[model samples]
Each structure stands twice: as C-alpha cells, then as structure tokens.
Target chain A: MGLTKSEIFSTEQNQLAQLLKALAHPARIAILQELMKSNTCICGDLVEELGLAQATISQHLKELKNAGLIQGTIEGVSVCYCINPSTWEMLEKETSGFFSSFKPAINCC
Target chain B: MGLTKSEIFSTEQNQLAQLLKALAHPARIAILQELMKSNTCICGDLVEELGLAQATISQHLKELKNAGLIQGTIEGVSVCYCINPSTWEMLEKETSGFFSSFKPAINCC
Candidate 1:
C-alpha cells in the first residue's frame, strides 16, 4: 500500500482528518452513543449494548482509545472506558470551526 | 472484503457514519476547507489550492457531493462547487448532538 502522504497537508488539516477518520465507522459511533447514554464507565458492556461480537467491540474500543477520544482503565479482567472530555471539547471546537466557516455566497449553488 | 453490515445500525448511526466517512479523507477535508475559505463558487481551484492531482481532487469532491455536504454547478468547462448550507447545518446538528451528549461520568477514568 502507498504511504498516507499526510505530510503534504497542513497540521490542522492532518489533525482534523485524523479525528474524523476515527469517527468514520458505525461501530465506533454506536460505542460512543452507548458511552454517552450510560454517562458512566463501561466495562465490557459494549458487547451486550451493541450486540456485536466481543472481538469487534474490543477492536472498536481500541480504535477509540488510540484516537485519544476515550480513556480506559483496568478493572479486574475488564477495562472500563469513558469519553475524554478534554478531547471531546477539542473535537467540538475543531468541527464547529470547520462547519461554521462557510457563509452563503451571493450566487453560489 | 466483507460487506459493510451497516444495516445492523440505527438510521441515525448509519447517517452519521456516512457523513463522517465522507469527511475522513485528507483530500476531502482540504477541499471543504478551501471551499469554506473561498465562501464563493469554486471551479477546479482545488487542484491548485491543495496541490493534488486534478482527478484526486475531483474524486474527493465527488465524495463530498455524494454526502450532500457540497453542491456543484456546471460551468462552461468545469463544475463550480460550494458548501450546501442546509446539509452543513444538518451535519452540525447531528455531530453536535453526538459530541455534546457526554457529560463526564461520575466515576469514569
């Protein structure tokens, strides 16, 4: 496979792409929704909540953790996960900034 | 490769995933940022602005257009593109709702 070539872009562009890519999957979105709804640490509860395979849920959780969007803590044999508020806030700011930048042009389609 | 299996998710989940997937690539992100900054119709300016191949930029624009994030109009020899404000607003609402749902859990990591 070819390299990402992410260096060709600006740092902000790369950062934004990374954040969005982390959010580009349905399983991850479901995991996040479950986390938000619970508003509490989730320890292996995603398997039941999402009705997805344990390995699939674990993989999604790993992606979220790697993205720094969520944090996990070991609890016995299970790991409890929760949103990283700071990262969430940062994501909000970045996404809001991106989406709110456009103003309807006088004669745009 | 396996099928996407998007049917297992809720409508909201699928919609959000589609939008995020459309935004996941750096080329698409760059195109959006360029369009936002322009705040005017753009006709093939992305190739120069992004320093990417014409076909690459065109493909990225196709994804953005397919996601309804941008609208294109045919000019004499090129298609002019601009952000679709309504769709952008929808995206903002959906993404904001998702991210803002999390109130730090009482005893989360």
Candidate 2:
C-alpha cells in the first residue's frame, strides 16, 4: 500500500483507498486525535501524550503527512502539526459515499 | 498492522483502525465494490473480475473476511462471500463519529 497500483482502479477508488490506508494504524489515529483535541497546531508534545518514542511518533507523523491528512509548519526547533481541514473534509465525503453506497435491503447473511 | 497494539488505545479506536487497515489495499476495495455491485454472495468470479492472480484475490478476500467486512459460505469447490451488513453499519457509524467529531471553525492549514 506504500505505492498502490492505482492504474488498476478508478481515481476515486484509488484516492479513497490511499487515504484509508494512511489512517490504518493506531499510532496515526492517536496522533490525529491529539491534534483534534488540541484544536491547534501541536509541536513536540505527542511523545508525552501518546507515551511513544520520539522517533516512532515522527514516523507516524510522516505517514500522516504523506497521506495529506495532516499539515506541519516549522516553529523554532519543533514542527507544529494539525489536521488539514480540506483533506479531512474530502476524506469524510469519499468515505461516506463508499459506506452509504449500499442500501441494506434485508438480512442477507 | 496485521496484529495491532490494541492495548494502546480505546476499544472503539482499535476496532475502527483495524477495519481501516484491512481495507488499506486496492485489491480489497475492488473486492468490496464487486460484492456491492452483485448484491449477492460472490465466489470465484473475483479472480476474473479483478484480473489479479487467484492467490492474490484469495488473500485479499481473507483479509476482508477476517475484518468482518465480508462473510463467506462454503459451497462445493469454492467459498461465496457477501458484505456483512451489521459490521458495515457499525463501521459507518464509527467512521462518521470520528470525522464529524471535529467542527472545522476556520481555515487552519
């Protein structure tokens, strides 16, 4: 999933899959939660909040950044990170479309 | 992500993350789309539909089934799979909760 074979699917499908893959980890989710709770750019505080090593948190942050889920700005020796609202909105719309596509007709178990 | 550190987060967060991880692949997404299109249990047709190797499709299907996103029934030489509606509903609710939790106030890039 690092680099998906996006040629195999529609752009919407590929984009949706890529975004979902980015959120597929607990560390990343925790990072996003931290950002949400703060409601502002967070810098160098995730390690203390999440109890993970700095390097581990950085890797998770990198993945989130790569997926365009979070944005960062340099501030002194630290990087301030926060959720990218536009991308988050796009994610919400695509995910809602995917999940709500199927109309549960009956218990077809 | 195969077996996440579930103890690190709340049960809801872990479950949602696990579900997203299972869906982190293009093949799995294609499989789900195929299931949705058919509106019934699908068996060996996926190998043909996705154009991936049979083994690859099998593995993807296994991941989806393991995540409770899809349910299968053994029938003769193959297994037929269909969406697990309850799990899908639960996933939708959890995902919506996570995304809608944030009230985007201003353009915070």
Candidate 3:
C-alpha cells in the first residue's frame, strides 16, 4: 500500500520482490502447498481443502495468478488451476541466486 | 495491516511468509544486495550507497534485523551491520524446500 520506490531497484530485484510479495501471506502459502501436493490441476477442491470461503480462496488464487505463480484453465464449467512451471523455475532460480549472493563472512559483527 | 489468518497455516509456512514479507520491498532487497556485496560488517555507508535518507535506510535495516536476516552491533559511535549466517542458511533451506515442494505436472491444466 505504501510507496515501494520500485523504480530505483534493478529489474531482477523488483521482480524478486514482486514474487515474494505474492507469497507473503499464509493463505497464499497454504494454497500453494495444496497445489503442490495435488500434483495436478485442482478444481473447486481448494475451498474444502483449505477450509476457507470460496471468495477468499479465489482472491488468493487471483494473487498467485497475477504473480505468474499459477495458471487456470476452463475445464467444462469449472476452472482448474495448477502451478506454472516456467514461472516456478524462474522463482526458484532467482531466489536461489539472491540467497547465494550472500557469502557468510568468517569474522564480522 | 489486515489480519493474515496465520493460525491456519503451519509454522513453517508462517515463518517463510514472514521472511518473504520482510523482503517484499525493493529498498530491503537493495540493502541486502549491498550487504552481500560488502561481505563484511558495514557501518554508515548504506545512506550514501542507496541515496536514501538515513532514517529510511535505518528503518529498512531494522526490518532486516527483525527478520533475523541481518544483525547489527555497536562499534564505537556507529552501528555495524552484517548478514546473519545462521538465519541466512535457515532462510535458504526453507525457501529451497518451499520451491522444491511444487513438482510441476506435465499434463492437464
């Protein structure tokens, strides 16, 4: 909600932050976990699985989609959702790179 | 801030989300980059490097410290800050585990 000043940071940093922001909520984390466990496109089961309202689940799903973490497809009448593999790989690589950037100093404050 | 409903998620999920939330800002990302690049405790150089006000830099640094991603120690008149190695390793493991959990489905949605 506040000014993030995203313009000043590198594209990589901003992108990483955006991805992390999408994952900064417990509900989203739960949703992601459910998708991971299913290992297939999930449709309408999330409400029961997460024990959250449909609207709430939908909201979290929308955030995930916006962050390119998940994708939804219309299957007949219902929409099925699953993890976006390319985006997931990108997130993994970027996150790993970010963490690897910090080498622990042997002696420091 | 609104309620995150953290109670519903597992401890690991909550901890990971909290760490991600701390890193959701570009300023914080930049700060982390600076610390990683320095590879040693840095004191009073962030303001000049980041081109942000001292107060703003301090606030970001405080958030990083609170997240246990960084630690600070009083060095004479200035506070020296460096990456917290143990916490960084924890974050790396947790984040890597999270990403590894999502095994992408080959077919379907």
Q: Scored by CA lDDT, what does every candidate get?
A: 0.84, 0.84, 0.87
Docking quality tier of model 2: medium
Which runs of model 2 end up more than 4 angstroms from their true locations?
A1-4, A107-109, B1-4, B107-109
lDDT of 1 by residue, A1-109 (tens): 3446687888888888888889988889988888888866876888987777898888888899888999998888888888989889999899988887777778777
Angstrom error of the Cα, residue A64, model 2: value is 0.8
Q: What's the DockQ of model 3?
A: 0.79
Native contact recovery (fnat) for each candidate is 0.80, 0.59, 0.84
Q: What is the two-chain DockQ of model 1?
A: 0.78
lDDT of 3 by residue, A1-109 (tens): 4677777778988898999999998888888888888876786899888777898899889999999999999989999998889999999999999998887787788
Model 1 RMSD to the real structure? 1.4
TM-score of chain A of each: 0.93, 0.89, 0.93
The reply for model 1, stretches above 4 Å from the true place, is: A1-3
Cα lDDT tens digits, model 2, A1-109, are 5455668777777888889999988878888887888876676899898867798889889989999998898878878888888899999998898888877645455
- Predict model 1's lDDT versus the native: 0.84
